[model samples]
Target: MKLILKACIILIILSNTAIAQRLYNTSEKLWKPQKDEAFLQEIATTIPTNEPVVSVAETNETCFALMSGNIYALKSGKLNKDNSAPAGVTELKNKNGDIWALTDNGIFRFQNDRWKKIDDKKYVDLCMHAGKLHAATSEEIYRLEGDRFVTTKPENGYYSSNMTMLMEDGTQLHDDPVRLGPISKIESYSGTLYVLRPGKLVLFDGLIVNEDFIDWGLLPSKNTRDMLSFGRRLFISTDRGMGVLQGAALKTIKGEEGLPVENTTCLERGFDQDIWIGTERGAVRMLKDEWHYFGADMWLPDNKVNDIAVGNNVVYIATEGGLGVINFEPFTLQKKADFFERHLEEWGHKRLGFIHTVYQKDGEWVREISDNDGGHTAPYLAAMCYKYAVTGDPEARKEAVESFNAMLFLEKVSPIDGFFARSIWSTTGDKDEMGRHGSGGLPAKWYKTADGKWYWKGDTSSDEVTAHFYSVSLFHDLVAKGKEKEMAKQHLEKIAAYIIDCGYTLHDMDGKPTRWGRWDPEYLLRPYGYVDRGVNGLEALTFMQTAYNLTNNKKFDDSYNQLIKWGYAANTIRQKNVFPPENLAPWDDNLAFESYYTLLRYEENPALRSTYLRSLERTWEVKRMEHISWFNFAYGAITGNDCDLEQSIKHLREWHLEPIEYNFRNSHRDDLFVEPGYTSYEGGLKAISPREKNITRGSRNAVALDGGQNGRRIMEPTGFIRDYWMARYHGFLEAPETNDPELTSVKRRTEQQFGAEPYKGLEKPVFY
Candidate 1:
């Protein structure tokens, strides 16, 4: 009933809103506060007490955050007590040889070791932009001219008190009705004034220069979080995570690359171009593309760094405990990488595998390289190889590819009739006992014997057919371009045959002949064990599409259509039919698989194309609003149309720290936890258990297991699904022209290098 109602609501909204208008619906919804009184109360109290002291300017030295509201100038790490300023200090500037500080009460100047306070009634924040000292307040903005502060608003439209200055010049200039209701705070950056209002971020590019403008909502935290300008963009720290504003969009960087602490106190620009983020848990410094944590180990006094300021080579941090100073320096990538490698090796290198059914040692079947219990090892190795490829390191690529080749020899039989065995070690590579090898059949399990013979077990279901299809498709692509052409061809043929059989039968695991396909066990449905058909259908379509590209067989095209029909059925069911609340498939999840294949195979379908654009917008909203950790980053990457590469890069960078952990019960001792570095298991932490608790964790035991990790123990279904999705969308795999301008440019350059036409737009070249 819940799923049905939710679907209805979604469909109704979709039907009423125009596409352009629909594009922003998700984002708008995220920015609105929920009605729950408790939640609202929590939000109301979530604001940080400290604001970032971005840059401190003085005539001869830099000013630093001293205590609560107090600031002091420092030269060579020594505080100039005579020039120290009190709380409520708004702006600091250097003019001629004099240091000027603006406050709400008055303006103060320091010279000859003495302080002179100038009685002034108006001042807020101060900055030196476009070669002049400017002060902006909640009411108005002004520029300093020699001995007097002059208003920047135009003389004709300027109002003395209530009127706000949208932009200011050396002289008063008014252009439009200033909307001050939404702006709570403002900062000046590179000739632009950034306004931070609840739920909105408005950028005024020409305070005294160009009149260009752009604005976007901070989707992650609605309007409750604070904003700080660091590097080339604005960073927003909300209850969920941190977000970076790019152009008119806000991209979240959470899970691993983000701070572990939730309540962010302040953000300041460090002297080495690093952004120092202060959170309740610790102080994080990001510089030269690396993030370093200063917490318990550094004697930070308190986890929360209330405010930060940099002077000369010293960094002053204000926290709940007190003020502290430390020498700051830039981080070198080489040194950082070396440090990470040491941590990775210390974590351990155990492998993970799946067993369908186990039996006592027998001579009837033999274990094959493909039948090896470590199912995830190959994909993990492949991911590592891809990483090395990105780094352009020849040695890493060689080692990764070699590992992949070793894993391939484990395949012994075909799981589906038309495809290779689902499990390489199974007697007959069948997931269940229901289907044959060549036609569209159900999933099955395969096992190998020590006597060089293979045996089969379990029920052969359609879900297994689809899983094998996807796995084989990825395997074939990975090896096809290299020297493993024959091996790739073998797997491709098996997958093609399996897909053909499925299209012909129209039957899946439930013993029902329907258009919809079954969900893979690894990619489980919500509320635990319940299975859905969308995943199966989507994977089949993907396989068919890949097959068409590989063989150019019209039969593959027909298969693709059959899969699409199932997709349409699922889509219609999701939109109009009755279902359970937890069962309703998220449009973003469906699009992760559906849109990729549609873009690749069904480019001519106008409805699909139009819906695809809308889907991307929806996906973006989901990512922006949802509290995603490093594990869920794949969802954002796969829905590439919704985000740019910059967001993907941010997520990838975060994963380097918050490594995913996998736990398995050992025979000799307690449960052992293994951590795979950033490249492996991007899907947070997960736990797996043997079907029987009595079974030992040795090589010979029959094990039962499930997987998922959500800051707590989860069953196998969620774990498997997260892993599969993460693998599917890991990194920027399919470089589309629209999504990746850099890759497109690189492709064009490669084409030029080879004297071929550039890979025009999103189309891939046909290899004869």
Candidate 2:
């Protein structure tokens, strides 16, 4: 049988080469946190209003909003007109289990869906203090006494000749008499009624107002917008930043303290132990020591926040355009993986086992026939490889095999032996709207297959080759078995042998080296390829090392030694280029890391290993600031050293749930610190979290100050899936301490919801 002959050939090759295979320990369950665990996922839903909403108040039953001189109640994510609400209402509040509305005619309370006049006098603000309703007019404050308003006078003895304006450090400033301008707002905190007047703060202790207590010197700005009392601290939102008053000590939370924007608009206490601060451009939640920002457009219909109200686990923000509701539900990284995995099928991103990103065409999702289909799908294939190795899930192996075959098909469908296509198009499908031009405007060579059924693109770049070896090597070591294992070995062997045969260049039918596919010493030693010599050399050696390790072929081992003899090893000493500022690109990092992982993993020669390790260390040091998750994970897995795992985990957690590529501009943020000019390259010294901006991949610049697709494309989540699963497999992360069952079932629920519609277009051949 063919199996017997293949076994004999492999034995002969192993005996001849005598190369010991060093493989990853896939069965080893080193630690947890490698698997996905349940956590809370924040979902933003925008509720549009007919008119600009002014204020919001939450009751035990529902939330009520005042809009255009009418009141509306929020129920089931909709606003219904409350006809019973009194006309000319200006403000609404929940006081003593009743809905109180401040109207032009008078003050009214709603009980059993009927409005009743509570007071005939209009008040500027109302608050509950010491189990009594307190109302404020322009000049005086009143308290309710048996359904009647009574004035509260200032205490006679507490008055002083001069008001002291002392700084937080107890520095005294000259002051004038106790002059309260007019009571504009009143709030209760720590058993004292603090009334807000223009530039003055008067305190009332049950009996009378203590007019001498005025907040002035410590405030960041005189024009304050909102005030809130949360957890022994009084927060005042102003145009500059938030001023915190904690037991006479004053501090500020501006750009330095992680406030996304300085000009705050409103503030409210959260349903839990947190505070919500609304800004001119977004909303921020301060929980303990962390800040979560929900930016405009992505999280709200408008940027100007008018008010905020908390209802259970949801926070309703009243923006200028409408109400922005944020709901918190349990979710986990594993659940996210499940969602993306299903998304590939439901969104029709997978075609013939090749994954493509989606873009809207005529209001429907259409697959983008991209040039780097092989390169893009590499992470997904590797993810399935790690997923199968970690969980021993048969489904993971099934998906992995299918994608691997698709990668193999790239070479199989090509005209030249060992040459692979960047992507393929079926003549049976609709015409290729993507056109035949590479990213750099080079003429793309699309050759018809002998069967006249498929058109395979030629002139493959180093990008595709690097991704191919990286992914297939992982499949061979982790997922392949029996015949599939042999197939993986042969696939790598042919590709490695072809480069050697063509003098270290991928030659097309014209017998010329394709652009960016040359790795020969003649090309590398030339001035044109001087900057590329490092990464290209590393990539060349990786192919030989991977092939020899997997196939035990002496030719690959011989070729590997020849490349080392040509000073390629020394070229890799500083593999990452930093000299020419323009050459400093993130895509090189992706290519180098992929090559370094394979070469270092399988190269047993101590000298080469040492040289590659040095290169990896230097490269990771430069990349650590970006907190690029894949690079961090690859470094940790290969080096077994601290790779800033915590920051990488934070980066992963901050990946936006909505994967749409929306434009983001962060150049105006005050917290940015650009690095030295030699290395800055329009990148911040510290990388911004993904939640604050657009989704990024390893090939794309993660630290770029500003850029996006403006919602024209949807980035595939395969990169995230790959990094997370790799972390899981390599023990960089551990299993979560607790897992919520409800959160864990999110994948199942999502599949049921969106898995119904069949994918459009002609069904291509299934690689599996």
Scored by TM-score, the top model is: 2
Span of ten consecutive residues with least summed lDDT in model 2: 16-25
Where does the lowest 10-residue lDDT sum fall in candidate 1? Answer: 36-45
Give the whole-model CA lDDT for all candidates, comma-separated: 0.41, 0.76
| Model 1 lDDT per residue over 257-318, tens place | 53435456566676667777777665666667545555421224444565565555655565
C-alpha lDDT (0 to 100) for residue 246 of candidate 1: 70
The reply for model 1, stretches above 4 Å from the true place, is: 1-400, 403-483, 499-533, 552-555, 564-581, 584-591, 594-642, 654-768
- Per-residue error (Å), model 2, residue 598: 1.8
Q: What is the lDDT of candidate 1?
A: 0.41
Q: lDDT at 447 for candidate 2?
A: 85
**Model 1 Cα displacement at 431 (Å)?**
25
> Model 2 over residues 233-315: C-alpha lDDT tens digits?
77878888888866556577788777777889888888779899888877888888767777766777777788888878888
